[model samples]
Structures are given as structure tokens and as C-alpha cells.
Target: MFAARRFVLAARSAASIGSKRAVHKGIEGTPPMRYMSVAERIAVYGLITVSFLSYPTYLMINLDNIRPKGENSLGDNALAEKERRAAVRA
Candidate 1:
């Protein structure tokens, strides 16, 4: 209860005091936003295209690593059949 009263008094005292600094005169002192130039636009577009296409490009590059070690081709079911036959023979 004492702490709460002290906190309220502090807040009231703080609220009564005014800041020494004045408020900012917004935008009047600053430059206005403008449209991008052709070169700037091209660079921005190029960056965006690179970011979006990078994942697919990386996946395409490392596609061979996605398959099983001996299965270089997608249709190489024969390799698995041979492995199974070898295991049975063993």
C-alpha cells in the first residue's frame, strides 16, 4: 500500500513536469519519397529474382544426391532387384 501510494505520487509528479525539448516538425524538414530510376529498378528486380530462384536452382544442381547411392537414373529398379537377389544368395 505504501509502495503503491509512492508510485502514484511519482507518476503524478512526472506527468506535471514538461520536457525541455520541442516536438519534431515531421516531413517538412525531410526529403520526399521518389520513384526508382531504371537502373535501380533493374537491380532490385534482379535481387528479388535471385532470392526466389536460388532454392530451385540449388535443388536442380544437387538432384543426383537426392537418389540412392547406386541409383543414378530414376528408372533403375533393376539395381534394387539385383541387390535383393544377392542378399538371398548370401
Candidate 2:
């Protein structure tokens, strides 16, 4: 469900790289404008879907259940260690 929201928001957004770009050619030997086909669009979409699904797993592996572990046990405690470090640096 969360991923559905994320995908819709991302896919529908104008800022997405997959979205069409209206690049115009200049007269100084610039190449002609190129159009993307449905197959190309589908390939880009497939890439986005794979990336979105795999991102959480990558995070879990690196972030240890999406939270710090061992020497940095902030967890639900939230930024307590950060404040302590700032206090020390001050």
C-alpha cells in the first residue's frame, strides 16, 4: 500500500526522469529531436518498479531493520545521541 502511494506519486510527478522532456534542437549542428516508443517507456517503467521494490530490502540490510544498531542505538529514542554529540562539541 505504501509502495502504491510512492509509485503513483513518483510516476505521476512531472519531475520524474521517465516523464517526457521537450528538448528542442538548436540550429548549430544539433541533432534532430528523438521520440520514445511504448517499448522504451515500458522498459523505463520496469526499471522504476524494480528499484522501488528493492530499495526497502537494501535499506534493511544496511540499516539493520531500518534503524541503527549496536554503537548507535537511537531507535524510537530518536536523536538523543545527536543532541549529546552536539552538547559535547559545544
- Evaluate all candidate structures by whole-model CA lDDT and list the values in order: 0.76, 0.71
Best by TM-score: 1
Q: Give candidate 1 misplaced runs (Cα > 4 Å).
A: 1-33, 70-90
lDDT of 1 by residue, 12-71 (tens): 877666332223345553543245687887888899999999999999999989866783
> Which portions of model 2 show Cα errors greater than 4 Å?
1-34, 60-90
Candidate 2: what lDDT?
Answer: 0.71
Lowest lDDT block of 10, candidate 2: 17-26
Pairs that collide in candidate 1 are none
Per-candidate TM-score against the hidden true structure: 0.38, 0.28
Give per-candidate clash totals. 0, 0
Query: CA shift at 49, candidate 2, in angstroms?
Result: 2.4
